[model samples]
Target: MSSSITTILTKKSYPPIGHYSQAFRANGHIWVSGQIAADADGNLLKRSMSEQAHQICKNTSKILQAAGSSLEKTVKVTVFATDFSKLPEFNSVYNTYFPQKPPRSAAEVSRLPLDVEVMMEVVALVDPGDEAKL
Candidate 1:
């Protein structure tokens, strides 16, 4: 059960607040960390739920690219929302990212770091040759 592990890093994505990589690659999979509505510069986007969701998804996309993957290759996704009432808004924005319907789960959390409205993370297949595109 020996597998090589690699930490994915990219300046085009937001820096991890703690001791964690934006994503990890091992055993043919890429596991991205939870992404909030923040840009690569770490500036939080404090806008409407739809906007926040869009930013979160965009952040995920960037991390996926940096990890030698893409949204189309995503196998699973988990979304954390502070307000269940805004699920529709979140879904509306999320649909634009995964129109093909990748497996996903959404949960209403008590709160998220920085008190953001939405956060998302994803798991996708790793394509080693895709690294240069990022």
Candidate 2:
């Protein structure tokens, strides 16, 4: 199977620290990388679990836009949290982004990069005629 792939880049979100694009546009969808509570300068937000969740959503939103998509278009999401006890806080913030309540999964993990408490990745449908943004 052959598919055209476009790397998505944007200054609105934190720069990727690893050898991976922030997102990719292909086959009429956008695949965003796991987003954390990092700022544009790569500094961790150092905020509460809910606050960090807000930052991740904001970052993911920016990445989706850069890839010709939006949070409302998301079809699936996966969340990783180091502290399961904070799930409520994360869910509270997450609900605001996906008011449509897209299918999602959350799991407790041992740890995450940069020692951040939470991380999220998403898959969303690309808006028509917006591939140029990729």
- Candidate 1 per-residue lDDT, tens place, 14-83, comes to 8998888899988778899999988889999998888988888888888787777889999999989888
CA shift of 89, model 2, Å: 0.7
Report the error of model 2 at residue 51, Å: 0.9
Using lDDT as the measure, which candidate wins? 2
Model 2 global lDDT (CA atoms, 0 to 1): 0.89
Give the runs in model 2 whose Cα sits over 4 Å from its true position.
132-134
Q: What C-alpha lDDT does candidate 1 achieve relative to the native structure?
A: 0.85
In candidate 2, the residue pairs with backbone N, CA or C atoms under 3 Å apart (3 or more residues apart, or in different chains) clash, namely none
Each model's total of backbone clashes: 0, 0
Q: Per-residue alpha-carbon lDDT of model 2 for 18-106, expressed as tens digits?
A: 99999988888889999999987788998898899889999999988777789999999999989899999889988988899999898
